[model samples]
Target: MTAELGGRIREARIARGLSLRAMAAEADISPSLLSQVETGKVQPSVSTLWAIVTCLGLSIDEVLGHSPASREPLRVEHPNPIQRARDAPEIVVENGVTWRGLAVMDPNVDAVLVTYAPGAASSPDDTHMRHPGTEYGYLIRGELTLKIDFETYLIRAGDSFCFSSSRPHLFRNDTDAVAEGVWFVAGRAGAASARSAPGPVRDAVDALDAMSRLPRRVGG
Candidate 1:
């Protein structure tokens, strides 16, 4: 249970886009100690836990309140297959990428079915962004490109991939045809502020600070 508590804190920190160092500084704890606590090497005092919770701007009560991950029963259902509809709640995050959420909402992850118009990219301008936890996607009926840091991958229909959300990553549809995919991101809802870069991979405060130092173009 102690280890579970530590892992919960770490997950929340990751989801908040906070690295061990930044969280430690804010919590007035040493980074090494925090790392040890997160790895279950050492137990934290109640005060220490409170400080961490305060710095992360989230509560661990949900994670500690239940052991659902182990004992919770999974729901089984066969709904008339989900179909994309014109009136469905959809958001165009960029010129080419449209997201429509799925019906299922789990505590550990969020689901979205996405449609990509030609030349659509989750990361516009070729800039990378990070998030918390992990990401999984399956190409349902089109081709899409995945970029993690500097590496690029081509995903076609029926192909699925998962990766750490902490790494700078994005998706693009550069083909002539529209593409569709089912996407899942492992993190609690509103895990990070909208202004923050989207991902669950690493310390986001540091990434944002670094981005601020880059020279700005007068106009794109």
Candidate 2:
């Protein structure tokens, strides 16, 4: 699955005529790290994956093998509202975080059950992720540390929080026990928002072209 994901990212970058360095720069990552991610030599953290997809103008669904056309068939074939646990798509990101999708075809919002193993973190580096959206999360078990910009809050089980995703934030499990939670994200830049919105394709192409033209940074 990791290799396949890498292949999809690589294909999308090439399709947009973006160099490895250019895409990495746009994603605010090192070119060597991006190359490793593209080759499946390493798996990216949740934040890194989100950044890469946003830079490539590709939806997380597409990267996860759920294209828009492919999703149509699912809606037509099964109109059931309840999703079976066995059928839920689960993605394990870098560190020890896991995401399980709750809905099959919801375009306006992304609902997922997230699990963070002991010592898990949303990002490997100090940089946090900021996107155009709002995030609501409820901690179901254990403890989690939520860092928003310069502030940090310790969240315990039964605690629920809502915040704008545009603020740089990171989630971490500092305790020895695992942390589990359900998160709902909605906005113009959520997981599926870019693909559902009109003109994203063109905008992505233009952005890629513009970024590709910039000279590579020294020692970057």
C-alpha lDDT values of all predictions: 0.62, 0.67
Best by TM-score: 2
lDDT of 2 by residue, 1-220 (tens): 8888899999999998999998787677999989988898889897788888777655677787874543211221244566677765565665677777665343445566888899888766545766545789999999999998789999999999998665668888899999999987664322443334333212212222222222221110
Residue 191 local lDDT, model 1: 38
Q: What TM-score do all the candidates reach, one by one?
A: 0.53, 0.53
* Candidate 2 ranges beyond 4 A from true positions: 1-77, 188-220
Candidate 2, overall lDDT? 0.67
Please name the candidate that would achieve the greatest lDDT relative to the true structure: 2
What is candidate 1's CA lDDT for residue 85? 59
